[model samples]
Target: MPRTGEGTTVRITIGRLAEITGVPASAIRFWERHGLLPVPERRSGQRRYPPEAADRITVLRTCQQAGLTLNEIRELQEERPRRAAMIRAKIAEIEERRTALTRAQELMAHALKCSEPDIVNCPKFREEMTGWRPASD
Candidate 1:
């Protein structure tokens, strides 16, 4: 009995919601199955979702796009005992990865600009390439 923006109560079918939100129906069902989503009421044996479910799916997709695993997103979404601790841990992990990726990008940029045919042969790069092994065996 949830009211949408039109001052009237409304419910959308799973397929319609999926098309509106760009989330697959199967993924919505999977999230519900895995406890990430609330179970919807069935009208005429078809799932019907409230408007709030769209916002929840948006947040879930955003979290996944930001590199959070399903378990991590679930931890953040749930009313759990250790939510804060888990959030802190995930933030730390993401920060570490961001720092590493930044370094890698900078290295690639430098390599691309270097005039040397083989970057490893350059004096500046040679010092940094110490003990680096070739990827191919």
Candidate 2:
């Protein structure tokens, strides 16, 4: 890491960038290949990133945790005209996943109270399955 004059033009090597971002160097390079991170300036053959790269990596990590694919993250980063559409699509996907998870929870809860030797043979469980519809439908 190197700083020049009151942090107005500070730069850090790739290793330092990874240290601050908690991302592996290989992963950072991968993102650069995929256009997720802008190519950094090279100082004496070593990649030197501005302090802001850490913030960009944080955003990438956050988006990944929120279930956005790398391509989706790239689209968001590029600020394409279809950004809103992509977000809406992701929201719909999350809603469907939530619905499926809720249904699974209900089934598990019922299983705990079920007295039948086999849950599949339980009358209540059978009725529930008959009425069950996938979220996509």
Candidate 3:
């Protein structure tokens, strides 16, 4: 890994960028192909990215961990004057998914304490999980 300089314009190769950012070279290349990362200046046969590339990679990693798809990240990167609305919709979607997951977790936790050997056969579980029915039933 190349040592970061003090306010100097130091560019590093893709592998070095990966080492600094803890991202894999393949992922960096893939992001470049997907327009997530701006194409860096090339020297000889190596791709050299500016220090700012690390920040971009951090943002990408964050968005991905927050459940944004590659296309969604690309959409965010390429602002077409409608990004705010799109972002609000995505937030709404993430919120909905988070809510559903919470409910699923609660249901599973309750199921663990259920006395019935077959949870689906438990009336209490059925009562708690109203509006859902087993396909076999």
What clash count goes with each model?
A: 0, 0, 0
lDDT of each: 0.86, 0.90, 0.86
What is the lDDT ranking, best to worst? 2, 3, 1
Better of 1 and 2 by lDDT: 2
TM-scores of the candidates in the order shown: 0.78, 0.74, 0.77
Off by over 4 Å in 1: 1-8, 124-137
- Higher lDDT: candidate 1 or 3? 3
Writing each residue's lDDT as its tens digit, candidate 1 over 1-137 gives 67769996698999998998999999999999998999999989999888889999999998888788889898998889898998888789888888777767866887988999887688877765553434666
lDDT by residue for model 3 (55-93), tens? 999999999988889988888888577877778998998
Model 2 lDDT tens row, 1-137: 55777875788899999998889999999999999999999989999898989999999999898799999999998768999899999899988889788889988999999998889999988888877755664
Better of 1 and 3 by TM-score: 1
For residue 128, model 1's alpha carbon misses the true position, in angstroms, by 7.7
- On lDDT, the leading prediction is 2
For model 2, where is the 10-residue window of minimal lDDT?
128-137
Query: Once model 1 is optimally superposed onto the true structure by TM-score, how far is the C-alpha of residue 112 displaced, in angstroms?
Result: 2.0
